[model samples]
Target: MPLAVVDAQTLVDSVALGAVYALMAVGIGLVFGVLRLVNFAYGQLVMAGAYTLAFTSHFHPAVSIAACFAVVIALSTAIDLAVFRPLRGQSPAVMLVTTFALAFLLQAVARIVDVRDGTIGEPVRVVGRLNRAVDVAGVNVRQVTILAIVLGVVMLGLLALLLGRTTIGLHMRAAAADFRTARLLGVRSDRVIGFAVFLSAVLAALVAVVLTVRRPLVTPAYGLQETIVVLVGVVVGGLDRLWTATLGGFAIGFATGLINGVLPTDKTIFLPTAVFTLVILVLLLRPGGLFAPRGAATVERV
Candidate 1:
């Protein structure tokens, strides 16, 4: 391919990748903003959604997608009620460890279920047709790429309105700003947290849909690596604010795509090393946050 062509394709792929990462970042950041807890089990939530899609792949695409969403949201809500709710008011460290435990537990359960039929990694082909590329202005773009970009923008806009206009959104914002004060002011913690989890789950399912189009196999740790990267992106962007966190996620993902594009195909194994090296450098330079304004006091507010 010509250098120009390669650059164009890289830009397109970067945008798509960044959009997906931003979605996941927002999901993680939302919960952290409101509850001050980083839910490490979030990848498992996406993993569960991927498996759900795999199991329901024989059905119509719409039906399978709907089932995926249902399973993820239900599982998210259950986790909150059964695990997180009881641990409420606990130290942030305790909650973080609990989430790690929950993540491992879910992954183990997935492995058991997957190996039950003597198959380790079952591939799900839900909406496989979307993987086909269509030419746009002489450039080939996968359908799912377009879908991801559109979905990310639409979801971000809707969420902005929800947080800006709705009563529930106001409560969530208040809770994020200060959980203790919000609770004292009659903002029901349960309802706010539950809604945040629900929204996160919805975003997770959407991510699964987009991801499975690119990677069809539904493995137990399917979403694990991506989650780890996005979490780092969240931190790099500033965990205290949602928009900055989203930007951070997108920035990291875009950089990854660009790096992958430029690297020799046979030596692509260095991608993670390169990415994290940049991350470390960024952190050293801006411990507060890369996207955060210079000299601005850091405040932990959503």
Candidate 2:
């Protein structure tokens, strides 16, 4: 590839990657902001959605996508009702550990079900056509890249409207600000939490769809790395605020892409090391958050 072409492609890929990370960050930030608990199982939810898409790959794309959404949302709601709900009001440490166990449990189940006869990954090609690239301003952009960008913008806008204009959104915001006070003031805890999880699952399914397009081989551990990276980005952006977390996710992803673009292909192995070294540096300099205003009170809120 020409240097210019490579740079353009890198920019497109970075934007798409950042958008997906932002979506995941939004999901994680929402739950954390409300419950003050980081659900480590959130990645497993994405894994489940990927598997759903793999299983339904033989069906019509629309049907398969719908099934993916249904499965993820239902599973998310079920987890809340069965696990998190019962443990509500427990110590944050206990809840966090429960999520860790839940993550392992779900991953193990997926391994058992999908890793048959030593085969571990299933190809999901329902949106395979999206892998093709098209020329845009002399740069080649994958169709799915455009789709990812569009989805990210639309989802973010809708979420903003939901939080700004709707009653449920108001309740969610209130709960994030102060759950106990919100509950005491008539914000239904169950409703708020359920909605947060539901929305989180929806975002996860979307992530799975985009990820499956980029990497069609769905495995039990799919989404785990991305989730971990996004979680780090969320913390780097400032866990106390939602928009900052989203920006943090985007920032890290963009940095990753930029690094990948500049490094020789043979030297790509250093990508993770470079990324994390930068992360450590950022943390050392601004333990609170990279984007957070200096001296800002680190109030925990959604």
Worst 10 residues of 2 by lDDT: 1-10
TM-score of 1: 0.93
Q: Candidate 1 at residue 56, lDDT?
A: 90
The TM-score values for the models, in the order shown, are: 0.93, 0.92
Q: Which model scores highest in lDDT?
A: 1
Per-candidate RMSD, Å: 2.8, 3.0
Candidate 2 lDDT score relative to the true structure = 0.88
Q: Top TM-score: which candidate number?
A: 1
Residue-level lDDT tens digits of model 2 in 90-156: 8878998999899989999999999775798999989999999999999989999999999999999
What lDDT does each candidate get? 0.89, 0.88
